[model samples]
Target: MITEVAQIEVLPGHEDQFEQAVSQAVPLFLGAEGCEEVDLQRSTEQPGRYRLLVRWETIEHHTDLFRQSQGYQRWRALAGPHFAAPPQVEHLYSVLAP
Candidate 1:
């Protein structure tokens, strides 16, 4: 499995709204093909900063499938407004595990 990490910065004073939006969009990821898990983390140092973690069966499940699906559009529509700027995203594979 691969993990997609998206570093998002929300506009000042929009933190609560952004978190709510992410919560509302959870089902979108859960219903996506090959999507195994979805989670969101906020920075303690910077309340406006967030990390969106999504685990997938493969990278294509994210970049090719989900990103191209209507759900992705809906995701952006729900959460895009609070973005201070475009998110920085990356994919990772685990090298070791317990």
Candidate 2:
């Protein structure tokens, strides 16, 4: 499995708006092929920061979704203006078992 982590810094006073937009946009990713699940979380120590974690079957699947689908564009349109800057995204793979 692959996890895509997106660390976002939202503008002040736009937290709820950003969350709402992400809520609406999540279904697009969740509905795509190989998307296992999606998680949206706020930083406990940072007032205007958020994190988005998306689980995929593989990195290839995640890449294909971004490269071939319109969902990313829609997602950007919905949440782009709320961002203070571009999000920092990282991909991770599990290396240890629980």
TM-score of each: 0.97, 0.93
Alpha-carbon RMSD of each model: 0.8, 1.2
- The model with the greatest lDDT is 1
lDDT of each: 0.97, 0.90
Q: Per-residue lDDT tens digits of candidate 1, residues 1-98?
A: 99999999999999999999999999999999999999999999988899999999999999999999999999999999999999999999999975
lDDT of 2: 0.90
Model 1 lDDT vs. the true structure? 0.97
